[model samples]
Target: MPNITDEQLARPFELKHGEQLLMSSPKLETIGSTINHWVHHRGQLTVYMRLNDIAVPSIYGPSADDRNFS
Candidate 1:
């Protein structure tokens, strides 16, 4: 994958999840699925953090644990 590029991400691909299957672009099947799955688990982690009184960091913006952008 050393030569990987946006062109490769645009290629077609297939996916199988449980009883479901899908045909999609490589970018959607790979990057999109990975990010979506990560965010799903991240939400679960936040719940655990709250239960332990641990501050959860913002993923898309400033959080109470972090406010400075600089």
Candidate 2:
């Protein structure tokens, strides 16, 4: 699932409630929700890492402790 592309994100997907459809969205929108959830956890973990004196890895770009971005 890593490195999903824009062409794939434009496609729609659905969730279901048993036999009934629950909801649906483009993959990009779902990604926004997932990223929001991840950011919350990332903030907490970075704080924990700082307190424990562990080097933080680069996420979007270079970090104080690392330069490799993932």
Candidate 3:
């Protein structure tokens, strides 16, 4: 999977306030995997998931998982 650039991740989507995004390499399998993981761990937290791909900037609280971009 290719690394998603900061610009790509920073691009805004049509997401609501508490929406969760599963990060993937724009591939079906990868996207599916991310979704599956998110479903399984939905009860854990309310942040978006950057699965099998790149990291997105945190808009709310700090994310130790990825560097803050915004």
Model 3, span 1-70: residue lDDT tens = 9987756655544433566654425344555666889766763343444553445444355655555534
The 0-to-1 C-alpha lDDT of every candidate, in the order given, reads: 0.78, 0.87, 0.52
TM-score of each: 0.52, 0.51, 0.25
> Which digits, one per residue and each the tens of the lDDT, describe model 1 over residues 1-70?
3877777778877666875876556774678888899999998998899899998788777766675745
- Colliding residue pairs in candidate 3: none
Q: Sort every candidate by TM-score, greatest first.
A: 1, 2, 3
Better of 1 and 2 by lDDT: 2
Q: C-alpha displacement of 62 in model 1, angstroms?
A: 2.1
User: Which sequence of candidate numbers ranks them by lDDT, best first?
Assistant: 2, 1, 3
Best by TM-score: 1
Model 2 residue pairs with clashes: none
- The sequence of per-residue lDDT tens digits that candidate 2 reaches over residues 1-70 is 5997889998987888898988899988987988999999999999999999999887677888874444
- Taking all chains together, the TM-score of candidate 3 against the true structure is 0.25
TM-score of 2: 0.51
Clashing residue pairs for model 1? none
